[model samples]
Target: MTRYLEGQTAIVTGGMRGIGLGIARRLHSAGAQIVIWDLAVDGWDSVANGFEPVMRQAVNVASLASVEAGFKEVVAQQGRVDILVNNAGINGPVTPCWEYPPAAWDQVIAIDLTGVFYCCRTVIPHMRERGYGRIVNVASMAGKDGVQYISGYSAAKAGVIAFTKAAAKELAQDGVLLNCIAPAMVETGLMAEMTPEHIAASKAKIPMGRFLQIEEIANMVTWIAGPECSFTTGFVFDLSGGRATY
Candidate 1:
């Protein structure tokens, strides 16, 4: 409503749906032009059509080549990217560490953690040259508290949290603030990947006794992606609804 981000452009990875779509809509509402990078899985066109003039880029965040090419296309069209929300990720199979398939673990790490690295590695330089930027990564509270039966997901997200801190320090003086949000379970399609028991267990851990709304995560991310969040970098903001105090 404030239009604080007016005249800026933002790229939201995996922005076709779920948490990524929520953040893209929020940034658009704040007056930033939206560029959605997604693999454009089935039924994606209908979702893309619902948005107001969103620039859609078919992208697979897990691949560095795809990420690089996507970044180039965005710059070519938008001129510059003022905000980047690295929200693309997948929750690997819900299984114990011992039972977790090695390939599943690698896949999760590639997309959830390594994808962030690829995006940051590609964009930081461009942002640094511009002398200003805001990047918010969507992490998870599971990374900190370590939820059972989701070892791959937990480890990948933990890596994301740590990655944010380390990158933020390097850009502290460069006017490029990097931060991440560690949210508890949210009411997103991502839950479809988990079993009912796992979902219930996650919700029960929240003191609020409820899952997070997509708009709530969007609200926090919008603020962090704005100029007002100038003082903090390399920090993890909590959106766990009292499940994680740290």
Candidate 2:
């Protein structure tokens, strides 16, 4: 692997399994120190992947104080964070809008939208001070459209896109490049948890007729986190395998 990211540090939220972990491994192989932050909902830890000298982090994206404490600890130990990947999100509840449980809906929004907000709030300021930063947000293709049965997720991801755009503009002059990746029907464990019927429906919509591999998303993020994205901010990179028209 190239050392394009050598001497850099990355904080990957939800970085224990699936998409986030894939990103961590890829970046590490490319010579970036890894900070793995996951709530243990899926037993996600960097040690399992044989990451030497991993920065183990315990974070609760729903709470601002938890994010503050977690990132503060990471910086105290690692010194600085050069890249921040906000990949923690939820598919949210499945039900008609009127019939969805208020708690479930709020829960999804809390993690997907508010979580990204908190991470950006805590990490970007440091980036601004350094006069450099690369922040990649993992939004979904559903964020660009209204998919049936996951309204909360769609809305939250949509918020991520808009938020990325605004933040990018604000930090562009500060050398902070903020962007969001919108992927469709990725074959992460998240998809594995969906009902077979829902999975089939999602597959049928993909023009490529298959879900994306975890590495595919990681590859996209890797480039965005590197020098290649210096000129691109507030941009949306599509990884839908042709599922979305726009």
Candidate 3:
């Protein structure tokens, strides 16, 4: 491993487990300081045993105030945040849109979509002032191709894809670069939240005949959040196993 990010610091929302955890571990292996932000992270120490200097903070991404406070705390301690991975999102409910509860829809939008907006809003100024930063928003293949029974998740992720593009353009002149990843149904704990039928349908859609692996997402993110990804921003990098045609 090349320790390319030797002195950089990275914040991974929902990083205590699953895909987020995989990404955090990979970034740490590359020598970037790791910060995990989640609603509850009780046993994080056991999982992050080798991650020396790993910091954990309680962050409810749905709240703008919480996002602001979390960013402030990271900056106050680390002096600066060089990378941010917005990976804290829910799968929402497995139900038809017509039958979806309004509250559930709002919650999905809040965490998956608006939450990205809030974090970026809070960090953009600081990154802009420093003239260097990297932000990787985790989106989904469902956002590009709507999945049945997961309308809320689909819509929210679509919003994330658009948000990444728009924000990247605004920061083009600055050293801050923003990009998003749209992965197919990834094998993670979040899949447990989906119905068997929903999972089956999603898997069948992938040309590779398998769900995406967490490490695959982590690999893509490692490069995107690193210094080599200089010329690309405002783009959606697909990890769909041939599911994404566009």
Which number leads on lDDT?
A: 3
**Per-model TM-score on C-alpha atoms:** 0.96, 0.95, 0.97
Give the better candidate number (1 or 3) by TM-score.
3
Q: Candidate 3: where are CA atoms >4 Å away?
A: 46-50
lDDT of 1 by residue, 1-246 (tens): 699999999999988788888898889889999988888844556455445634788888888899899899888888999999999999989988999999999999999999999999999999999999999999999889888999999999999999999999999999999999999999888888999999999999999999999999999999999988989998999998887766
Cα error, candidate 1, residue 161 (Å):
0.4
Cα distance off (Å), candidate 3, residue 180: 0.1
Question: Model 2, 52-113: lDDT tens per residue?
Answer: 43576779988999999999998888888999999987786666788878998899989999
How displaced is residue 7 in candidate 3, in Å?
A: 0.7
Residue 150: error of model 1 in Å?
A: 0.4
Candidate 3 per-residue C-alpha lDDT over 1-246 given as tens digits, one digit per residue, 9 for 90 to 100: 999999999999989888998899889989999999999877756544557445799999999999899888899999989999999999989998899999999999999999899988998899999999999999998888888899999999999999999999999999999999999988888878988988899899999999899888999999999999999999999998988879
After TM-score superposition, what is the CA distance of residue 207 in candidate 2 from its true location, in Å? 0.9
Candidate 2 Cα errors over 4 Å, as ranges? 41-50
True lDDT of residue 155, candidate 1: 91
- Candidate 2 Cα lDDT to native: 0.87
Worst 10 residues of 3 by lDDT: 44-53
Query: Per-model C-alpha lDDT, please?
Result: 0.90, 0.87, 0.91
Off by over 4 Å in 1: 41-50
Q: Give the CA lDDT, 0 to 100, for residue 169 in model 1.
A: 95
Show how many residue pairs clash in every candidate, following the order shown: 0, 0, 0
